[model samples]
Target: MADKRDYYEILELGKNASEDEIKKAYRKLARQYHPDVNKAADAETKFKEVKEAYDVLSDSGKRATYDQYGHVDPNQGFGGGGAGDFSGGFGDIFDMFFGGGGGRRDPNAPQRGNDLQYTMTIEFKEAIFGKETEITIPRTESCDTCHGSGAKPGTKPETCSVCKGSGQQEVVQNTPFGRMVNRRACTNCSGSGRIIKDKCGTCHGAGKVKRQRKINVRIPAGVDEGAQIRLSGEGEAGQRGGPAGDLYIVIRVKSHEFFEREGDDIYCEVPLTFAQAALGDEIEIPTLTEKVKLKIPAGTQTGTYFRLKGKGVPRLRGYGQGDQHVKVTVVTPTNLTEDQKELLRQFAGVAGESTSEHHESIFEKMKRAFRGD
Candidate 1:
């Protein structure tokens, strides 16, 4: 007993650790060192040590006794009562680690159907305005011929003789601590609780059939890319009179050639000729719905952004529309006649000392305008 390590040290917990903390630490260490999961030679030995520590620390009475007397032989009644006082602890620990040993589940109970997801790609404009379309999907549904009974036309299924409709059986084992009872699905009826003598030809005793179903989905207005629309009770059919699951339509919007969207706002770049940018002009800009005229202010520099209020996409959740932002890019002429070049040279000579100075002046003005100075 003196050679045994302290329970708190085995769990890597302080003496003042709470019960929840102790359980969490034990579960972590147990999973890490469990022989089935960990292949190391010492894993099984470590797992046993962790289990022993947990068995002593997890119980309030055992913990108090161990805290006062340290490790003592169970045959000597640790403190007062015999080892038989701790009967159901190991069963609970087994259920906690292995799962499905807690209690029996009803095989005939209604279970919600599995949810389904479908990805659909739509045009960019369709995402902003929303659209309704029908799509076909393959899914399993209750057998129409047998009405989900898995039996022949006139015959019904019989209760499983092995499990007696409970759908599970108990396996008793004698462990080192005591006898442990574990519950498992019955092998006779394969946990369905019923045996079909004459199976339905259509579903082959499965009680379900696969079919292509067409369903109409309504995409809400202003739904963006990667958005999802859910249709209630439109997925795969449920079993044993259960409610059907939901169908989720995942939206994938195709990229637009002219516009980019951010949240509800729209953004697009428009090219302006040097003359049009210098002298100002009203040019037609294309939006999601129609073309609108945007006035270019004289001396509008490249990369300058202009906001058009209430011209972007409509808000999906609330009232009012987002503003459209237009970025200006001044386009320099590549092809110029000798006479035109001479004329531009004469204009530049009269305008400033160098073109660099003019660019500096324009850049300064752009900075001031951005700052609202």
Candidate 2:
């Protein structure tokens, strides 16, 4: 096996990262390296690494084992006794619940359609304020001619001869211990328990046809990125006359040019000149909907955060809203004019860095005032 990187390092997280932190990091990394979204040459490799790390770290037991050993042999882990043993775990569980080798599936029974996932990218504002929009999706629909029966209008399906309408094929495997009997879906009948004698010309006996459909979707307000909404009976048609599957709309919110979000709270950095930092001023700042006036306090330091209550993104389901944090960054003058340079030098001489016999430090004076001393 190849030498594996630490799960924590792979996720770009510290060893003391919390579950929520791990999940958040994994999601961000997963989105960056997902093969469907990212087309970089190393994207697939990076995605696999992210997935493996999440798998180990997300589980407490696995995380404990990994933390102790640094490298746990996957094959030797609990329940990973052997490939064959683990493979049949689900089968054994099913047998335990429903009894072994009995209650065979009736292929003609109603089977729910396969669920479909559609990833949609929406604007950041649109995500904040829900929008009702139309979407065109191509999905499998029951054939009009055959009505999902997969047979001609006049002729019906015939019984499958291979499995005698049971829709299953039995396989006997001889192992060193004993005989392993397995029942698999019949290839001849395709698990339907029947075969169409005369196939429908429109669907060619598949019982379904691919067609484009228009659907209206209502996105609720305050939905964040990676949120999902399920639409019932919107996916591919089920086999025969069964119910249709659901369509899951996975959201991807487009990033705003100026804003970065954490939870419902939004953050933006505003640059301030030395004069603006020293002298209080009223500045216009952008919010999700409108521009608002932000009051800058005198002597504002770099990286000072001001919170505008109820000015951020709306809560997903609950009432009220989050706050917008404006981080003030003091920018130094880039170029100096002759007069401006001379004035600044004079100002610096007057406002010396340290307190002297003739001058008292402004910082110490402010501190004394705050302490009421």
Candidate 3:
């Protein structure tokens, strides 16, 4: 057999590296040397080497055994004449750190799936009132033929010989202190303890395929632009029986022509004639629901606000509705006719020295200011 290589040298990790650091290194190297992506002449062999290094460094018990033995074969009998076996009790440790390796795989195992994001535009009114919409997303789904197992029907997986079904390998080293031991996951099985001899023809052993799927989502009321709604278990399906991720729907609300909304309140500008401001009158004002008559008090000034109670948008999660605020702007008539000017001159003569209750009150203030009081 070829000379056995040092695990730390294979993984390029320090002897004192933590478990988390070892895992991080493994993930980085695995992604780089995975057979599906890397096609170099020795990429597969390098990948297996990295995996083996990680298997030893990630386990505590196996690392302890290897530390005491310095390449002393673990299969050799210990003390007595019985066959030496260091593989026992490793299953519990594996299960504690990396879950179990039972024939029935776990559905929550981490796996990569295409991330999906959807942009949906809605009318302002529709966003406030809420609506149901259907969307079609093109993505990868679990393979139907293999049922996410990546194995052909009637064929079962075989134990990984490299790790002897322990999902890891032990390595012993002679150091200055004495001997050091380490245990790393088997590169051949990716810590799965088994490998598929025959892959599903449909998925090519990936257990997933690319396709488009349609899903319906219900948007709640009071949603705003840039708001995100998460649809759980609706994203692309995971590979190898892993659980699916989530889908995010980003909301974009169109601008409104008549009203602007702030939180639950609605605002609008209304124009009022000079006559309406000078003389108290009941004028129809537009609201979200319908037009309502509002009384404009005599001597009403421009930029005055009139509130219509409970006329704005409904609260999304609360009990009460918001109020509608109407801002009034006075519009003065321009380009009077000659007849109207003459009539206004005649009327001015009669109205010159006389002040009504509303006009007198304002004129008194001006007079006082002129006197510098």
Arranged by TM-score, best first: 1, 2, 3
Better of 1 and 2 by lDDT: 1
Better of 1 and 3 by TM-score: 1
Ranking by lDDT: 1, 2, 3
Report lDDT (CA) for all predictions. Answer: 0.81, 0.80, 0.71
RMSD of 3: 11.9
Which one wins on TM-score? 1
Model 1 local distance difference test score? 0.81
Candidates' TM-scores? 0.81, 0.64, 0.57
How well is each residue in 1-373 modelled by candidate 3, as lDDT tens digits?
Answer: 1365766667677777788887888877876776545789887567656755665567786666545763454654221213323332223333433545423233234575556799999998887778998999887788888887778877766778897676776666543223434465668888767788899999887678888789999998777778899998888887555668789999998988888888888898888776788787898988776789999999887778999888877787887778899998776556879986566556655767433434543335544653657
lDDT of 1 by residue, 71-112 (tens): 775546443222333333333445567783644458988888
The residue ranges of model 3 lying beyond 4 angstroms of the native Cα positions read 1-116, 164-186, 190-194, 239-242, 332-373
Q: Each prediction's Cα RMSD?
A: 5.3, 16.8, 11.9
